[model samples]
Target: MPRDRPAPDLPEPLAPLIDAHTHLDACGATDAASVAAIVDRAEKVGVGRVVTVADDLAAARFAVDAANWDPRVYAATAIHPTRANVLDDATKAEIELLAGDPRTVAVGETGLDYYWPGKLEGCATVEEQVEGFRWHIDLAKRLRKPLMIHNREADHDLLAVLIDEGAPETVIFHCFSSDANMALACVEAGYVLSFSGTVSFRNARDLHEAAKLVPDDQLIVETDAPYLTPHPFRGAPNEPYCLPYTVRSLAHTRGQDPVELAEASTATARRVYRI
Candidate 1:
């Protein structure tokens, strides 16, 4: 079935911000020109830079190239947990080479996604995901880069494995969707939480509460673009230019100033990604 994706429009601009995680490859960016065009749109709406994340080998390659192609772009690479079934010697070796790229800021978009294993065909089983997650964790640690994690309905296992593997110096839970307890646990353990558009949904009360509790410095913002478009714009085709919607929404949820949150989040992203 075709998605009834709308022609998404960027909202009123705010102070400049960085989209901590997004997928430029999925947002119609195929080369330097396309990447520049997408980024130009974002720059008009307060999004100064973006970290294009990869969920597979092809995306991994593109992400690195996009980072090099555009000064305002950075990259994070890893095979997504749902597709971890493809991990092998060749895959790992290439990913390592990509991770070493000065433009590649993190080793991830990887972790467990128990939500899809049974329902989705070709999804990696729990065992395979575990091995892949551990390998990515090690890669991040070795590279001295932050680990960007993608977790869905596997909070307990995700936290456990991070403990078991001796987590990298810096860890980020991208699109953090867990509740207050999980939020507190992450805060207590010194892991950063990057919120997305879902935090803007009114019914996500637990997530709202979680957002309120995160320390200002420990919280960052993302679009997870080409996905998780914010309310009033939900179901629309998302891109980095749409990030202001999520940013202002998160600031409202946390009772903070949107401009301040934007500045702080951008600083946190810069420090974490070192871009």
Candidate 2:
């Protein structure tokens, strides 16, 4: 594992904001006290609400527990598409139960990841991923919550499957990694795009364009913590407190004020997740 870099200093604060998607467990926020401390730091910087997402049963449970631990925290549960091969009936039942929790606001961090499988052994097959994704979509619709998606090198299939299966009332492309065209298509479909630290990298020109393409109401921001730490702090440990950096970068890309963008994202998140 890559050793986390020294934690970065706080960025300039924004008005109270929301991390639409994050991973507190992966960020080493394991217990109530730790989760509280993390949220405290975020609150200091105006990130007042956070939705921690899960990739599997263990993480899903942790997300729910974290939410119950703090009112500022909420949860989104699912078997990540990369782990789709493991979505057995028992696991599905457990996720279904968790999805029904009032604090569980969405049915993902689930979708397709074609980046790792064929090049690496022991990855879930495309067929397995598709099966799991469809199941998750159903859960989102049944539960009347937004569907939070994780699309990596599988944009075409992700959009196709969502359209074919009929998307839930709300859909969020978390850490959206597609180009301008895909962003336009998703916008046309009324899906919200949640950008992450990747948007801050100078090399992410296409993502910058996509960020610009997304209307203020359709845009959101996240840390995707413990990964995708923003530029100048790349490879550093990321947490919700670090979100303002990405928000500022996103605001720059969209030619909007940071505070304005922050307000829009927070409102959009609350609306989509029904928080």
Per the 3 Å backbone cut-off, how many clashing residue pairs does candidate 1 have?
Answer: 0
Clashes of each: 0, 0
In candidate 1, what are the lDDT values of residues 1-275, reduced to their tens digit? 11467756777887679999999989888989999999999999889899999999999999999999999999999999999999989999999999899999999999999999999989999999999999999999999999999999999999999999999989999999999999999999999999999999989999999999988778889989888888877777888898888888899888899999999998888888877
Q: What are the per-residue Cα lDDT tens digits for candidate 2 across 10-95? A: 88888769998999998888899999999899999999999999998999999999999999999999999889988988999999
Question: What is the C-alpha local distance difference test score of each model?
Answer: 0.92, 0.91
Candidate 1, residue 15: lDDT:
66
Candidate 1: clashing pairs of residues: none
